[model samples]
Target: MAHRLLVCRIWTLSAKEIRCLPASSTAIASTSFSTSLQPSSSQVSFLSPSHGLPRSFTHTTRRQVSFNVQDNEDFTERVINSQLPVLIDFHAQWCGPCKILGPRLEKAVAKQKGRVAMAKVDIDDHTDLAIEYGVSAVPTVIAMRGGDVVDHFVGIKDDDELDSFVSKVIGK
Candidate 1:
C-alpha cells in the first residue's frame, strides 16, 4: 500500500502526461511500475480502473533537469533561445564545491516543473563560454530569461537556499 502511494506521488511529480486505456485481464492480475534516472529516458507505469498495461507500452519522457552544453551552437539553441527561463551552471570537473552544488541545484530546478531549465557548462571544456560569461571561479550559476542575465550566485548553496534562488530566478 505504501509502495503504491509512493509510486503515485512520484508519478504526479514526474509525469508529463497520463493516458488511460482499457485494462486487460492479465494486467489486472499484477501491478507494476518502472522508474529510471537516465538522461535519455525515464518512465513510470500505473494501472487505472479502465486502463491496463499494454504489452508494448510507450515510455514517457521526464522533464530533463540537467542539460550538458555541447558547444557554442548547442548552447545558443538550448540556452539562449530557450522560451523558458534558464539556469546556466558554469563549473569545472575538479571543483569540489561544484560537485556538491550540482545535484542540489538540479533538485531545485526540478521542483520548478517546466518553468525553468538548467544548462551545465564545463569551464575547462568550454573556455570561450566561461570567459565570455566572466566565470573566473568554479560553481558559478547564472540565471537568464529571454537571453539576458537575471540572477546568479557562486560557490555552494544549501538546499533551501537553492530553492529560494531558483524561485527568485523564475520570479516566483
Candidate 2:
C-alpha cells in the first residue's frame, strides 16, 4: 500500500502541468531555469507550458545613493566637481572592517536624501585615489565640499555614530 501511494504521488507530479505566473506586473522580469530535485522555500519553479522546463522569476529594484569610483578621471569628474558634498569611502575588498562599514556609510548617506553623495574607492582597484587622499588604511571616509577635504575618519562606526558623522559632514 505504501509503495502504491509513493508511485501515485510521483505519477501525479509528473502528469501535472505547472505554469509560471508573474508575481506582479510592475516587477522587472529576468529569466532563469532550475534543475534541482527540491526547491527551497524562498524559490518557486514551474514548468513552462511551451518549453516543458522549470522556470524561475525574481524582481529587484533599489534607489541609488552612492556610486563606485572607476578611475582618477571619474573621481575628479564626479566627486571633486559635484555641487553637493561628497563622501569618499576609501576601502579594500579584502578588509573586513571595510565590508562592515560600507553599508553603514551608505545608509547614513541615504538618510540625507540628495544632500550628499558617496564615492566608493577600492584601494586595490584605485590605489592612486587612495594614495592621493592619504589613505594608508581600509575604511577611511572623507567628506569634501567645493573641491576641498572638510572632514574624515578611519575604522568602523556604529549606526548612530555614522548618522552623526554624515550630519556633521553636511554641516547640519
Instruction: Quote the positional error of residue 43 for candidate 2 in Å.
Output: 25
Tens digit of lDDT per residue, candidate 2, span 39-109? 54433323334445433346666679999998888988999999999999998889999989999999999
Those runs of model 2 whose alpha carbons end farther than 4 Å from true positions after fitting are 1-61
Runs in model 1 with CA error above 4 Å?
A: 1-60
Q: What digit string (tens of lDDT, one per residue) describes model 1 on residues 1-172?
A: 8767755544554222333323442243224443345332433344443444334557999878889999999999999999989999998889999989999999999998889999999999999999999998889999998899998898999999999999998883
RMSD of 1: 13.3
**lDDT values for all models:** 0.80, 0.78
Highest-scoring model, lDDT: 1
